[model samples]
Target: MKLISWNVNGLRAVVKKDFVKTFEELDADIFSIQETKLQEGQIDLDLSGYHQYFFYAKRKGYSGTAVFTKEEPLNVHQGLGIDEFDDEGRTLTLEFKDFYLINSYTPNSQQKLKRLDYRMRYDDALREYMQKLSVDKPVILCGDLNVAHEEIDIKNDKTNHKNPGFSDEERAKFTELLNSGFIDTFRTLHPDDVKYSWWSYRFNARKNNAGWRIDYFVLSDNGKKMLKAADIHTDIYGSDHCPIELDLDI
Candidate 1:
């Protein structure tokens, strides 16, 4: 099965700019989106033959996630079940017969690390939640994790250090998560590939190929055998983030 994950930045906005065409072209078995940035009834998308699931933030025009799957899942879940994090509508989980797929939009620490404390707390809670789910079944976690995990993952690592998405704390959290039993599929599959999934809108970042590989498909360690192909679709455009894909033999 081919699964795709993208942080569309905003569903309403992207849909106006070739989102439907892009969606149809990708033709993934499961397509997961983050940062929908809308509330209920904001947009009525017509995606035939796919089951649509949307999770909205309590606040309008804010964080949200959506999932489109050709196959109907056995069950679906939203959030990590923590009041603080659940309010943001950051995660959408679908349970299949053999595994769990979680699409997430991890919180950014924000300018000057203003929200760093909250982000740390959120990461810890999310880690615990993912670990709990992994105990039940292998989990496929993907989305804009908001951290440039390694120096090779970001273009200006030296200058971006300690910034919102490149901070030491955030990187450590991601490392800990992997150590706890998740595999960074793209990096594992293409260790030397300097590809990025996200680029800044300003400073001609995309034009110059200055970007960060913040979006990812992280699989439960035991599910490594299921990973067939992983990629960062840097050529695609709509949002600042490009879609990442993970193909599974299962």
Candidate 2:
């Protein structure tokens, strides 16, 4: 099955930028979107062949996530069942017969590191949530995690070291997540590939190919062997971030 994840930046904005056409062209069996920045009744997507699920943030025009799948899931859940984290509408979990698909838009640490502490707490909660899910079945997690896990993940690593997304603390949390048994599908398959999935909109970064690989598709070890292919569609032009895709033989 072909599964694709992207941080659309804003659902309404992207719709005007040919989101419908691009969505059709991608032709994924399952499509997950983060940073939708919309609320109930704000916008409607006419996805004829897919079942849509959305988790909207309590705050309007802010963080949110959605999933569109051709195959019906056995169940769908919103949030991690934690009141503190659920308010942001950052997570959507879909349980199929074989595995759980988690679509998340991880909280950014903010320019001044103001949210760094909250972000760390979020990491702890998310890890526990993921581990609990893993005990039941393999989990496929994807979205704009908002952190560059290593020097290899962002261009000009030395200059970005102290930046919110590249902070050592944030990167180490991501490392802990992977060490806990999840594998970053893209890196696992193409260990040396240096392409990135997200870019800064400033200074013509995208045009210059200066970007960060913050978005990802991480899978439990049990789901790793099923990976067929993984990719970043850098050519897509709606959001500052592009889509990351995974093709699974299962």
Candidate 3:
């Protein structure tokens, strides 16, 4: 099955662009979008033959996630069983017969690390949650994790060492997750390839190809053998971040 994940930045804004067209063109069996920034009844999408599930933030025009799947899942879950995190609508989980698909939009550490403490707490909770889920079945975790995990992941890794996304704390959290069990599919597939899924709108970052691979499709060890292909679809553009795809044999 082909699964795609993207951080659209804002659903209503992208819908005005070619969001629907891009969706159709990808033709994925499962599609997940993060940072929707929409509330209930804000927008209606007509995606025939796909079941849509949305988890919206309590605040309007804020963090949110949605999943459109061709196959109906056995069950669906939102959030990490924490009210503080659930209020932001940062996670959406769909349980299939064999595995669990988790779409997440991790909390960002704002400028000057203003939200770093909150972000750290959030990451710890997410790690625990994912670990618990993996105990039952393999997990497919995908989204804009908001961290440039390695030096190769960001274009100016040296200069941006202390930046919000490239900070030591954020990177360490991602490392902890990987150490716990998840494998970053893209790096595992193409270790030496320098590809990025997200770019800044400023300083012609995307135009100059100066970007960061913050978005990812991380799979548990049990799903490693099933990972057929992992790609960063940098060509398709509507948001600052492009869509990433994962082909699984299962």
TM-score of every candidate relative to the true structure:
0.99, 0.98, 0.99
Candidate 3 worst ten-residue window by lDDT: 218-227
Winner on lDDT (2 vs 3) = 3
Q: How accurate is candidate 3 locally (lDDT)?
A: 0.95
lDDT of 2 by residue, 57-100 (tens): 99999999999999999999999888778999998999998889
**lDDT order of candidates, top first:** 3, 1, 2
Question: Candidate 2 has what TM-score?
Answer: 0.98
Please write out the lDDT profile of model 3 over residues 1-250, one tens digit for every residue: 9999999999999999899999999999999999999999988999999999999999989999999999999999989989988999999999998889999999989999999998999999988888999999999999999999999999999999989999999999999999999999999999999999999999999999999999999999987888999999999999999999999998
Off by over 4 Å in 1: none
Candidate 1 clashing pairs, residues 3+ apart or interchain = none
Candidate 1 — what's its lDDT?
0.93
**242: Cα error in model 1, Å:** 0.5
Question: How high is the lDDT of residue 169 in model 3?
Answer: 98
Flag regions of model 3 displaced more than 4 Å.
none
Number of backbone collisions per candidate: 0, 0, 0
